[model samples]
Target: MPQANIDPAIKSVHVFSTGAGEQHKEHRYGSPLPRLLWALTSQSWIKIPVNAFVIEHRDGLVLFDTGLDPAIKSDPNYINSAIGRFLLRRIFRLHIGPDERLHKKLEAMGFAAADIRKAVISHLHFDHVGGIADIPQADLLVSKDEWAQLSAPHPEREWILREHIEIPGAKWRPVEFAPTDDPLFAPFGGSYDVMGDASMILLPTPGHTPGSMSMLVRTGDTPPLLLVGDLTYQADLLMKDQVPGTGDAKLLRSSFAKVRTLKKQFPDLVILASHDPETADILAASHSSRP
Candidate 1:
């Protein structure tokens, strides 16, 4: 799409890290050893940011994903299941401060949690939806397929905690993607236009999770931004067709191919991943550069 044809509803895009976490090198760069082997025995670790994005649209503020909750560090009973808690300790190490909470992060950025009109969740991972409770008034848009996982037996095993997501007074809306005739988005088969203005379109990426999705932000003159949550830890990894240690390998490759195709269509497209350590700098450069 031409820059002139892009939507101008988006005024600016910003990102904030709720906190940082340490993951095994295998978990991030991939490993030959099985997940359990690495999770249980690997001593190598890499610190990564738990990031969330803010899109300043003319109509209202929008969040790509809510970052990690501080409660996970403060509350011993954050994860309900004993096994889940044990596995979490072995799998990752989190570093979050009270001020890093979603509301506080937004407030520091000159935005209020109440001012948020919509939060397009990329997936149901605890870190992704951690801030939902802070923004109860906003419509939480999650992929229908992702939301269905909650009904599956022992969802917590997959790290989808019901207590936090199904919390009282939270507005969770399952999104059903509709078929789009637009050539640019036809490969995705369907899309959900968040504002019904083509400013932000949600595409089913699915790989990191069964129903994971990505948001395409067309901000007129600037390069288009794709908020790909956990699709790949790094854009370079996705470009190289490298799969991470977790998630379904087959699905990850398929989604990676689709995103690559979109990148081909728009050479200047900026792919942002939730935990990619370099995303903040890349986003800043993308905003500073002209299309």
Candidate 2:
């Protein structure tokens, strides 16, 4: 979309880190065999931040994704499956304080869990949906494909725990992306305009997971922002067509190419991955020109 076509309702955007975790370096980059070998033998770790974004729009506060749940570290049964529990320990090391709970984290960020109107879940990964329990009143939005995983024989096998997701009183909505005539989004094929005004849109990027999605945010003053949840660990990797150790490699490449096309069309477009270690510096630099 052209810079002139931006909306004015969006006042500002803020990025927050709910918690931090460490994964094998190979897991953040390279092929599955290397990742497995590194996981099995190498102690080299890469710190990744579990991020959630808040958009201050005219309508209300909208959250791109909810960060990790602190309970995963303290509660023994967090993963449920015996194998999952063992695997989780080997795959990632998480560090979250008692104050890192979503509610408290939001409070620290000058917002409240109760104030969130809707939360767009990029995918149903356990870490991404962990904060849903804290914001029960907010409308939890997920792609139809992502939500469909819940009905599968065992969502936990894919690391999406149904038990944690199907919490009582939580309002979950599965949304279908509609075909769009808009040229800017034509490359994406389909999109869900979150605010009706096109200030925030949900685009199906897939790859990281079959139902994985990304959010596009545009405002009059700031350059366009794409909140891609694990589409790539880093924006540079997407630009270089490098697929991570996990997910469908073929699908990931397709999504990466499309995102690069969008970036080419809008060079100033900021691609923020949920776990990108440099997200804070990138976001701060993007807004440095303003007061």
In order, candidate lDDTs are 0.92, 0.88
- Report lDDT (Cα) of residue 140, candidate 1: 97
**Candidate 2 TM-score over all chains jointly:** 0.96
Highest lDDT, which number? Answer: 1
Tens-place lDDT per residue, model 2, 1-291, is 486776588988999988899887777886558545666775778899999999888989999899898888878898889988877777888998766888888888898889999999999998899899889889999999999988888889788999889999999999999998877788888999898998998999999889999999988777789999989999999999988888888999999988988888878999999999899889888886543
- Predicted candidate 1 versus true structure: per-residue lDDT over 155-206, tens digit per residue: 8988898999999999999999999898878888899999988889999999
Mind sharing the TM-score for model 1? 0.98
Give the number of the best model, judged by TM-score: 1
